[model samples]
Target: MNEPGGSGGAEGVRLQKVLAGAGLGSRRACEELIAQGRVQVDGEVVREQGMRVDPTTVVLHVDGMRVQLDPDLVTIALHKPKGVVSSMHDEKGRPDLSGLVADRRVFHVGRLDADSEGLLLLTNDGELAHRLAHPSYEVTKTYVVTVEGRVKPGVGQALKRGIELDDGPVRVDAYTVLETSPRRSLVQVDLHEGRNRIVRRMFDAVGHPVTRLVRTRIGPVRLGQLKPGQTRVVAGNELGALMAAVDL
Candidate 1:
């Protein structure tokens, strides 16, 4: 990453990356903006996608409006309650994350289903969010799952081995029996896959439907004692560990 523009003589970062990190959209979209001559650097119309600029010192404008680099990145850990939609808005008028956080600009890093509840990271730092959501980073997410019935002996091992889902093959990084009863079993599972409704579907595929699910951890960040419908800023070593997880 290029150092923030200063007299230290650091080279400027790629224009598209700077624009994308500023929440302009994807790098591709930012490239399009540059190609269309909508972006200007230091009063010069920059059409070249490879052009780099110092975000801290260089003046950037898109569509004639000044583009300000976000000086302080805000990341929040939210314990999303059940029945709340993961999106900013729901067509059905269902409750969403927007109600919990006053700022509509910050977006959820990854999604939890309406029926699922757990630690959901919301942030204005699009680049970090992109890295976390991307499967290549292999950020492990740990979950405590409650299934409808006692999992059979081989089931846990099977999940650890691998399972063929509709999208592709997936396997848990770790799996352990937390508690088991005749009617229900609580199991802790860790996986890097971020497919939609994966935890519930994984158990459902194994003939044991999920009764309840809660994500306990994402990378090194834990949900801890955060209550449902509550939000808190991620800070200190916890935030540092998360950024390090994605090589940010």
Candidate 2:
């Protein structure tokens, strides 16, 4: 049921695959959403897992809401502040990253918790967002953390080796106690996994609570000198570097 010239095969493609490629979720999750009567096509609720769509002509919906496919995509980087959530809106009426950007349609490539700050990416490219956010891609994220206690000797090594997370084993790609003193320290942690609350949990596992966590880099893109609440369009080479980093 595909219209000709769609990026994925237009002739025959599974509906869940299309939704997942559109960054709604993984294919399996999309199937569950479909089963729960949450997905629709061409204004009709579609529960069939194998339903086909022609990207050129078909319209998709989820939960009675249209999911428009973006033809003109934009990607931007924002220096997110700690208080802003990484969402378009918060029902509790809290401020979110969307308040700082001019493009209202852009979605975040990945999310930072409301209390986490630093290099947050905003984009309308669903496939790119999926690639960047998925754990299998293993895009390296770099964070500078100020901890409450001085890092014990070999703590960095311990982090690099592995830490026991609630989900499973997690390890940093690179870990270093950059600056250490009697009572506090600045630690640099690099990870390919984007697990929830990973950096904070890793530090907590080591008995050093994270006082502040700011992600300085994500793959080839860096937060740089951008002040909090500032944002900029991702330029040519920088954008290319990021895509390359994710093997897009």
Candidate 3:
């Protein structure tokens, strides 16, 4: 019904082609999905054989999942190394996030201070970036920390119970001691708080000052085998789960 008596042919690309190009499937398979009334454009199901859509301007959903088609939009995951600033431009002239993604006009989704490093995402998609970075969204981040002196099991328990900070009480969603020795300890922590230098401050407050910190995970994305100072495009299942996380 969206074909509009063949006027759709004069403008926009074919819907099935757009879907297939989006990695949904082959053209025939996308056509089958459209015929099954599972392809939607701007919230309306289109069952026409040759429905055309301006992908950049239309919200396309297949089987209730969004399909991003704007070629201008991108999201990149960077394993930021220590000493690199998260800002796109640094007046201090130190290496920055923009140099890492020189090809894309994007900004870092969240800040990873120069002292700490791990999975950092940069994106030109404003909505996706806002949703991922906003405090209203309870997206947990996992950090592996090394601190002075051995951390006891009690500290982990106390963290879960919540610790009082200058601003307010801070609590971890999860914490585990990965290693402990006489001089130093290693631990993994998960929290949703995005306050400035929060993890370090929390450990300091508990008497185990953090010596090293690396954020290992942010929601569905992982650092994995990505070495320091490397980046990969965020797409496919990972992208799907991310958008699903923030209701994009």
Clashing pairs in 2: 1-54, 2-54, 3-54
> Model 3, stretches more than 4 Å misplaced?
1-12, 32-51, 62-64
Model 3, 126-213: lDDT tens digits are 9999998899888989999999998876998899999999999999999988899999999999999999999999999999998889
Which ranking of candidates, highest lDDT first?
A: 3, 1, 2
List clashing residue pairs in candidate 1.
none
Stronger candidate by lDDT (2 vs 3): 3
Candidate closer to the true structure by lDDT (higher is better), 1 or 3: 3
| Model 1 spans with C-alpha error above 4 angstroms | 1-71
Candidate 1: tens digits of C-alpha lDDT, residues 1-248: 43223223336788899988876789999999999999777767888776667677776667755555656778899999999999988889999989999864799988999999999999988888999999899999999999988889999899999999898888999999999999999999999989999998899999999989999899988999999988888864576568768865
Q: Using TM-score as the measure, what is the rank order of every candidate, best first?
A: 3, 1, 2
> Considering summed lDDT, which 10 consecutive residues are worst modelled in model 3?
1-10
Give, for candidate 1, the lowest lDDT window spanning 10 residues.
1-10
CA lDDT, every model vs. true structure: 0.85, 0.80, 0.87
| TM-score for each candidate, following the candidate numbering | 0.73, 0.70, 0.86
Instruction: Tell me each candidate's RMSD, in Å, in order.
Output: 11.4, 12.4, 3.0
**Candidate 2's C-alpha lDDT?**
0.80
